[model samples]
Target: MKEDSFLKNSVLLTASNITTGILGFIFSIYLSKLIGPVGIGLYGLVMPIYNLFICLMTAGIIAAISKVSAIYKVKRQYNNISKTIKSVASFNVIWSIAIGIMVFFLAPYISKYGIHDMRTVNAIRITCPAMVFIALSNILKGYFFGVSKIVVPSFIDILEKAMRIITITLLIIFFKANSITALVTLAYLSLAIGELQSLILLFIYYKNLSKKTPSSADKPERASQLLFNVLIIALPLCINGFLGNLFGTASTLLVPRRLASAGFDASTALGMIGKFTGMALTIVTFPMIVIMSINSLIVPDLSETISRRDYYNASLRIKKVMKIAFLLGLATTVVCNLIPTSLGQMFYSRDDLGAYIKIASLSAPIFFTSSTMFGILNGLNKQSIILRNSLIVSAIEIVCLYIFIGIPGVNIMGYGITLFISSSISLFINLREVQKHIYLNLSKSNIIIFTLLSILIFMILRGLTTNILNNFITIRNIALILITFSIFIILSFFGIEED
Candidate 1:
């Protein structure tokens, strides 16, 4: 694709991601309020397991599909692309069905022993069918990404999220599913329906796109060989995903247990975990939606650049993207620190949620930067490095969670500190590896200045708003603060460009 087209695709995907993120954020707020802390806790507890299953069922096939498809598209081998998609999709479906069955049966054991909550058993079982739909959707999404048709996948994302929100709301109102188990089950079912909708939409798009492209009448590869090739590319990624997520799942599950060990009861510990994961961290990572969208769009471009041995351009792109991500992270950190209390009150109506957001916000820059670095590494085909980084960070996080959660003084905030340290370490390692290939033109002074200015502006405006408005947590005050902060953020960007 041309440079202009790449830029347009990036912008389109970013806009879609921002819209989806906003809708998802709003949905989360409504769900949290409707279900209360316990319901939120239950949902949070089930997520790691769900993610693990997804990682297993998809088996990194989506990424493998994208990479393979992109290469084929570049080589004008359209037939091979279809064969690749078909083989991967077939393999994914088989695995998803097998895994779904396992999950359906093992839900009781996992809920009883793994999570220590029987309340999640039904939710876990309900999540099983969703995996099949999710697997198919991922295959189509991967194909779209590979072919550089981001709009299809991006639109599907927004549609899926909207469907989930609408379905869940209607179900709750019409069915009055107020119990934690009922709500959680309904939530997972809505997810399944959303995936089905996305799958159907993408299938239609794929059919149309296929018809438009000329077919090479060449003979296709044998199914066995195709599957083997796909697995060669996918297995390592899948293993990396599985092991990394295994540790992450363990760490997440351990949080409440460790908190309990620190003197809290089951209910209190789970509730605290819920508050951190569901409310505080949600607010802290909201900016990542855009950052991640940028990463997604850049990966394929970076892959194409690397394929053509264009290191100079790739390095420049990395530096520019990372700088923007860094600035956004810094701005978000400042905003979070300045208005965590007000934010929590506004979003979840809980002062404690705001307090936790303050702690989590400190990790914002590291999280954002790490994501960018990881994208660069992945684009460069350094999957092993990415995997190693995940392992190292997961280990460190687990150890930190254990040590700090056991200490009475640290408690839940230990997770926040762990997040900061692990992300910093991962980013440091990624940067070191990245510099080996191309020197990153990172401006330390500019970053320092931007950080200082953002914080200074945020504090000044925060104080002014609070004094003038008096009601700090009111919607009007929050709106004024947001508008001022946004203006400062824009001005800061222009100032950096001038420097």
Candidate 2:
């Protein structure tokens, strides 16, 4: 792939991701206001259980298809691309339908025993259909990413998020849901509706696009072979995702119980989880969608390069992705630290979230860096390594949460502590593994320079924006962000972009 085209596509997708993220973030603010903190906590509780099962169905399918499809597209094996989607879509339909049925039937048992919250039963049931919708829709998304046809999925996603907001709003107005269960169930119902719309549109677009493309001159690849190509890549990732989410689900569930053990009541514990996870962490990680948009393209870009033995460009891709992830994270850290309370009050209108936002922001840089490693490893065909490392970290995370959250004073602060430590360890291990295969042209001194300069910029911006317009939280924060990026853009053009 041409670097210019790759950069162009990345920029386009980044714009789309940021737009969708902003919409979704705004919806979260609305949801938090409507549901209140404890309700957000209850909603948060059932989501992990929902996500855990979704992982079981759709986990690595997208990455797998994207990688396999990119490699095939490079080799001009268009038939294989069609075959792969068909086979995977069929499998997903059967498998996901079965799983959805099971979840629907088992929701009550799972909610009571697995989540330890009987109130979540209906909400859990509502997610079963959404899981099925997502399972099939992902095949089309993966294909689009692999073929570099990002615009279709990007538009669809933006529309889906907007419709999601509208759907939930209408549902709430029409039903006037009073109890927490009724309200949370409406939220999940909106998710299912949104996914269904996405699935229908994506399938139509994929079909129309296929009809326009020239069929391969080469003999058609077998359905079995097509399935194998993706499964070989997808299964390891699926296991990694599934087990990682499994451990993640356990960690999430244990938080409330552990906090209660630490002397907080059940309601207070849930409220703490809601403030930190739903509000504070939500705002802090909102910027990560930028990193994710870039990383979404990384698997395909690196896969194509590696297939042609283009290790040089592959290394460049790796180095570039890591740099962007780390720097964006650092910028996030500086802003969060500079005005944590202001952001909390600005976004969610909650004073209690100030402490959580401050603490969670500390993990930004390391967590962002760690997240970039997954795409690089996938490009290197190190899915097994990803799986192994993820399991280890997942195990470590549970242990960390168990020990830390049980401590009385630590309470919800344990989540922040665990995030920082886990991300650092994951980054160290995964980065080492990646370097063994290809040398990253990473500059050590530049990273140090960048870190120090980021601090300096933070001080300068805070002095001007954070305090002077402190009363105007909205204007002050926006001005700080705009000025920070403007300076960085100017620096990049003059000196920073050179070396």
Candidate 3:
């Protein structure tokens, strides 16, 4: 890879990710309208189990492949790189298929006992195939990331998302599935189809690329050894992700049960969980769709910067990205706060979403900024720290949700409180570690200026969204968000230039 690997890959990935993220959110909104909240809640219930299974099966495949393949690439051992992917992919095929079989069989148990909703049985079973598909796709995705051929997987992901949207819509219409359970099950089936499409395309690309690349004639490593090489790197990451997701899945499953325990009926509980998690949380975290791409692609680049003791550059990059994260988060927060109803109505057509949206939006700034810390930690080679902090925070989340959601008064609102507290702690722990390594040299004056200017923008946004352009719900919401950020960026250029 060239010295400018990050720059080129970042640009390619940013465009791809932004496209896919926007589409994915649009798909979420579409699903919301098509299935309704209760359906979404049912869908949501099955997803965590699906995700946990996928994480357990394929969590570390990408990073491990990227690491091992990159090393082999640098050594000009193209054969070894190909062989490593073959080894890993082969194992994942058998591994994921076995896991999928288990999920299919255990769906009834999970739906009945774990989720406390037998309606989710079909959805859980439907999601099993997707776990296998994603498991294979991750291997190819990791290979692309390793060789810096980001465009392949990037393009494939966009296509996959598009396919998902089309497939789900078509399946529902074709089947005329009106029941929530049937609809949710079909959604997972669509996901499986899309993942399968993505995997097939990835394999095609891999084959073509391998055929063209010149191979070194050195003695090839055994398949088992090659698999070991990848697994050695992947195993720890797999454990970290699995454990973290274990906590995350628990937190997810607990919400509905906790609400039910608070005296809400099962339907009402699922509805609340759907409104908050599927709808409100998605709306609030919209900016992270782009910010997260930045976070993901920057790790290797930041790690390189840190390795060379280029603390100054590293700090500058951190400051720049964090500012973007903060500004985007702040802008999202303001828009959501001022016109939560407008946004809720515009996107979801639900007058009821305003309450959840308002509460969820409160975390936008803190959550988005903090979300980047994991990427920063990865750059700092603080893998163990990330694992530890994640486990600790997950523990905190479980405890908070347990206590808060059980209270009759707190109920759904507890989700918001838990989100705020967990994000704050994760931010604090990760940011402290970052500060110790690189003196961020953040400009206090700039922070103050930006904060003040944001207040002013909030007021302007308030007028524009609530009074002046309020009648045109879509335009008012969209234009106000765009214009607010436009002014902020222009003002920052003139008044708050950290550079």
lDDT of 2: 0.87
Query: What TM-score, computed on C-alpha atoms, does each candidate reach?
Result: 0.94, 0.97, 0.93
CA lDDT of each candidate? 0.81, 0.87, 0.82
Scored by TM-score, the top model is 2
Worst 10 residues of 2 by lDDT: 490-499
Worst 10 residues of 3 by lDDT: 490-499
In candidate 2, which residue pairs get closer than 3 Å at backbone N, Cα or C atoms, i.e. clash? none
Ranking by lDDT: 2, 3, 1
Candidate 2 error regions (>4 Å): 488-499
lDDT of 1 by residue, 1-499 (tens): 4678777877888899989998889888988887888788889989889889888877567777777788777778888888877877787888899999999999999999999999899889988888888888888877887887877778878988887888998888888887888998888778777878888898999989999987877776777786777677667778778888899889989998899889999888878888998989998898898788777767678888987898878887887787767777776777787777778888888877877888898988778888898678878878888788888888999999999887888899998899998889988998999988776656777777777877787777667766565464576545754675476557544533321
Question: Can you give the lDDT of residue 412 in candidate 3?
Answer: 93
265 Cα displacement, candidate 1 (Å): 1.1
Best by lDDT: 2
lDDT of 2 by residue, 279-396 (tens): 9999889989977887788887887788789888788678777777777788788878877887888899876677888899899988998999998898788999999999988988
